[model samples]
Structures are given as structure tokens and as C-alpha cells.
Target: MPTLTIRNLDDRLKQRLRLRAAQHGWSMEQEARVILAQVLETPAQNDGAAWLQRVRQRFQGVAGDDWQPSDRREGTERELPHFDP
Candidate 1:
């Protein structure tokens, strides 16, 4: 395995990474490796599709054919409030 060295990273970002690694019970190096692998392996379309699938799955029951969008036309003609000095 080859060792990687990163340069000029922000101090805050490093702290955030350390905190996140601790939250996930990982060493900073292991967490970085996992993040790198995930980012490299997943294509953007696949990531988007996966996210859409998860959302659809979550609302599958409420998203039935009976659903209807409410009208936005009612507010279109409303007058703006006059601010008098």
C-alpha cells in the first residue's frame, strides 16, 4: 500500500474530520480512506438515483394517485401592503 500526504489543508477542516472520525468510531486515517473510496467509486448519476430511490421509498405510501397540488392562483392578485411615513 502507498502512503498519501496531503498539504495546505485548513485547520478547521482537519478538526472537523477528527470530530467526524470520532463520531463514527474510526481513526482519522480510516475515515479519510473510507470517504475517498466512496467518493471515487460512486458516479454522480448513481448517487442521485440512489438518493431519489430512498426518497421515493420513504414517501411511497403518501404519493398515491389521489394526491393533488393545491392552487397558487389565489395569492397572485393580492395587493402589497402600503407603508406610510
Candidate 2:
């Protein structure tokens, strides 16, 4: 892991970060990290349909129609097993 030194950071921006960190109950450093990760994070695709299309294009004519299960779709819930204590 490398250390990042933000030199000559603006007072207002730093104060805002402090407030945000307090709101989220995080340290300033943790808040900065979360902000950085969120800003730099690249979403696979905003539109799920577009993402599926891209996957299909990448695997175009590869083989086997049964590779994708018809039962599989996003947000399908399964019941969790109850544990006896």
C-alpha cells in the first residue's frame, strides 16, 4: 500500500470532509477513502440490458444454448435456513 499526500488542501473542502465523516461516523481518513473509492469506481453498466448484450457479444457463437439457466435472473430471493440454538 502506498501513502497519498494531499498537499495544500483547501480549508473549506477539508471542513466539508470533516462534517461528512462525522455524519457517517467515520474517521477523516476513512471518509476520504470511501469518497475516493466511490468517485473512482467504474460501474460495470448502468443499464443491465446493455451489460447482458455486451456479455453476449463477447461470447458470441461460442456454443451451447443451455449455458444460461432460464431460472437465473437478478433479485430472485431464496429462503435462508433456520438454525436451531
Candidate 3:
């Protein structure tokens, strides 16, 4: 594994990390690794539009406020499903 050196980390932040490490029965380094792993496992959702686009792509033909009947030529639409955070 590659080595990582954190320079000029805040004293209070370091203290908090130490306490968290102790509470989890892990070394500060191990705690940091676990935190990083958990965070990176999820895709970032900072962009609402982009997140909505992904949902549409994943559920294509099943969602969107612009949905229409395959046989209909008129501009009919339906409400997209509500998603909770």
C-alpha cells in the first residue's frame, strides 16, 4: 500500500479523530481508511439535475414528467415518481 502523510492537520480535528478511533477500537489510520472507503462507495449527489438525469436513465420509460403513451401522438405527460433522500 502507498503511504499518506497529512501535514498541518488541525489540532482539534486530530483530537476528534483520536477519540473516534478509540471509540471504534481502531488506530487513527484505520479509522481514516474506513471513513474514506465508506464515503467513496457512494456516488456524489451534489447536482440535483444530474442526479435526476441518472434516475431517468436507470428507469428509462418508467419515469419523467414528459412520459407519453407509445401509440399517442399528442403531447401528454405524467408526473415523475417522488424520491426521498
User: What are the per-residue Cα lDDT tens digits for candidate 1 across 10-66?
Assistant: 999999999999999989999999999998887775578888988898988784688
Looking at model 2, residue 14 earns an lDDT score of: 97
Give the Cα lDDT of each candidate: 0.89, 0.89, 0.88
Model 1 clashing residue pairs (backbone)? none
lDDT of 2 by residue, 1-85 (tens): 9999998999999999999999999899999999889867956476798889999999998988568766666688878989999
Worst 10 residues of 2 by lDDT: 65-74
**Model 3 steric clash pairs:** none
Query: Per-prediction TM-score, please?
Result: 0.51, 0.49, 0.56
lDDT score, residue 56, model 2?
Answer: 94
TM-score: the better of candidates 1 and 3: 3
lDDT of 1 at 7: 97
Which parts of model 1 have CA positions greater than 4 angstroms off? 46-85
* Residue 67 CA displacement from its true place in model 1, Å: 22
> What's model 2's lDDT at 63?
84
For model 2, state the Cα shift of residue 67 in Å. 44
